[model samples]
Target: MSVPVPYHATAQRPEWSSLPARLRAEVSTRMGAPVIQARTAGAGFTRGFAALLRTADGQSAFVKAAPHAEQPHLVDWYAREAAILTRLPAGLPAPRPRWTLWEAGWYVLCLDPVDGHTPRLPWDQAELTATLTAFADVAEALAEPPVELTALGLPRLADLARDDLLWWGEVAAGREQVPPLPAPARGRLADLVTLESRLPRYAAAATGLTHGDLRVDNVLVDTAGSVWFCDWPWLCHGPAWFDLVTLLITGYATGLDVDSLFAAQPAAASAPDDALDVTLAALAGYHLTAATSAPPTASTNLPAHQRWTGEQAIRWLSHRRGWL
Candidate 1:
């Protein structure tokens, strides 16, 4: 629960010069004007090429390029994100992907750049309020699943939770080793498993599309103080409160009265009484287990971020359950 470093600052992105000349030319050709300036995005864990490109004729676009020869997974993720963005409702406060193309063994996605910056840590009260309000609008807009959108084969959150979100159960059954824990939380694997295992049952009834990944780094605050969500590869059907929980974890880490803040949001209004506890338990298990695994070749800071997030989750859960 300590004030940790900014997660996004740790990423090592590909420079503009590192991109293939052919692909860069294709981007210029598509923009219909020579590139005048480019500023790389300072956030994200991936090593893909992401930057705001400005043309001599005053046109600007946010471009992301992933090389199939190297970051193949990133290519797949970026391609999937582009496909999802086009189908998202127009009223949502998310950036729209404008176009996508393949050139020189790389996949490229273009989007309209937002005039904004990442929210600062130890979040300003107004910024946090604005973000929560904007996402409430998002939850309202996607309350019901659209046939065309659902037809894209987005996985149901409950199914995903059952498959990949139960690390405590793994440890309880001796399939995975237990990670270090607080003094009071040690030897509580059965309790952790009990809480984490209920996620599927609790999430199964949800029908709305949720932003599967809702971290502070993925959010942008514009000059007008409006919030914009980015990165859409994890979109799925789940209760909107799940996304709210993910966004507010950092708030809790930073010492915000997130319990009350969460209650005030419309997204959490319909959530079950134990919904927050269930999510925090599952998150603690997932991140703690992940922190013990081998780090990705890229994303050097991921392990540290995972550890901090897991500890914060466990701290929140313990306080709520009176584990002390």
Candidate 2:
């Protein structure tokens, strides 16, 4: 009899009824029937509207929308997701795009509905195993980028993390507030900054398609126990073990024996220990820096989530380095 803590809290969702009438009509037209019910999706931090919609004809689809006026960046994200989903290899365990529309100053996407549940926080071992297995399969399946998505111009891990990881240096120079760091991590800020500087070099050898953002909420477990990965906005080209490292950080924070888990993964096992350390440092710096900033519009809980994740990353780094 205890309330379960969510992996991350989602922001308030815009109701299906709140969409403009023209947009609703277009969605109904695409689904081939009038939507009779809409249940808001209870996962993710984006301010965009997402919901499971059922039509009068019993058809169902996952619909997501974001108005350009409110979230211009999200509109681009949705467009990117639509493009990525369409180009994903056939048989990948991800939702298929049914249709996408840009009208009435809103970008809308309809996808094949995935009947699954988000993984529990702290993770159930079996669920975690399934997700890991799926990550490996997906990574292998997407070893190279598809021809259609080549124009996405996804930045390399090195380029993306190089500047973002310097937030600690900014904090040290009094340009930004000190993010909440554990006692052990507080005294080692300089070391972290130094470690972060080497991230690009460590990340340089990475070569493979990667789900840039991998976390508990972005994954789903179907009734048959298969794992389904979602949120393709951050899809990019990076190291084969990139997603695994991200997941292991969360696992480590939740007290899982991530070292053993990493050893068990073929992709992860191939990565050098130093490379993994650099990746962790990069992630820790990025999260810690973003966590200290002002909350993003419509995502009031994002800063808190980022702060918690930053703490976890720092704690994991401290353990790895035996920092005091």
Candidate that scores best on TM-score: 1
Off by over 4 Å in 1: 1-3, 294-297
Question: How many clashing residue pairs, candidate 1?
Answer: 0
Per-model TM-score, in order, reads 0.96, 0.93
Full-model lDDT for every candidate: 0.86, 0.78
Model 2 stretches with alpha carbons more than 4 Å out: 1-5
Clashing pairs in 2: none
What is the RMSD, in Å, between candidate 2 and the native fold over all Cα? 2.3
Could you report the Cα RMSD, in angstroms, for every candidate shown? Answer: 1.4, 2.3
Task: Compose the digit string of candidate 1's lDDT tens values, residues 1-324.
Answer: 453557547566887777889988889999989877888887777678888899999999999998898789899889889888888888888889888999999999999888778887889888988898899899998899777788889988899898888899998889998988876678778889988888888788887889889988789898988999999999998999999988999998889998998899998888999999999999999988988873464566777788888888898888878889
Worst 10 residues of 2 by lDDT: 1-10
